[model samples]
Target: MVITDVNEYRLELARKMGVTRAVNVAKENLNDVMAELGMTEGFDVGLEMSGAPPAFRTMLDTMNHGGRIAMLGIPPSDMSIDWTKVIFKGLFIKGIYGREMFENLVQDGGADSVWPRSLADHYPSFLYR
Candidate 1:
């Protein structure tokens, strides 16, 4: 399951990545969607890529006890967190920064830079104006 802001492109990407469920967090009731995804109590793993504070909080709130959350979002410096829940739930939080390995792979020709370009070209009408 994947939750993201209302964007068909993002949903398509998640579907291609084998996501069985994709919830548009920007539309309708998020709690209802979470419930539909069986995230009522919480989730086992939550990956936050959206930089919105609310999204981060929602992810935290919807995480199961002893669950892990990996965040790549860049929140504001003065952002607040519910430390009480963190401690009580025994949640594991991991923060990631930089693209060292990805850069290395690009530089070493292990990955192709033109791949994205090709994909974009393949769906020009869908991606471009």
Candidate 2:
């Protein structure tokens, strides 16, 4: 898997963890780096760990069609995303908050969280629910 970060230390950690490709966004061009790494169609799944607005946007821009994204970090107070692309490309974005919220709930309770149940009951089209 490819890990993208601005910190050298984190890149090194990712590399040590078996990620052969890591992008230091502060120093290299992301598209060029991905291209050099032979990724033409972009990633199939993206784990948005940084929660930086730019990182989130980049993930949205670079994911393949029908891409799924799980976010772990806290979002910026003033974040903005392109909803048009999300709808057209059939992107699925799920927010994973800290212990008190969804991700932990889903993980610990196996889709028993109120959010998933609500979605499943109300919006049958959303299969993720």
Choose the strongest candidate by lDDT.
2
Give candidate 1's TM-score. 0.67
Which residue ranges in model 1 land beyond 4 Å of their true spot?
Answer: 38-40, 97-129
Q: Tens digit of lDDT per residue, candidate 2, span 25-114?
A: 888877887889888787877878787998988888888899988888788788889988788779988787456554554775634422
The lDDT values for all models are 0.71, 0.75
Residue 67's lDDT in candidate 1: 90
Top candidate by TM-score = 2
TM-score of each: 0.67, 0.71
Worst 10 contiguous positions by lDDT, candidate 2: 113-122
Looking at model 2, the pairs that clash are none
lDDT of 1 at 46: 77
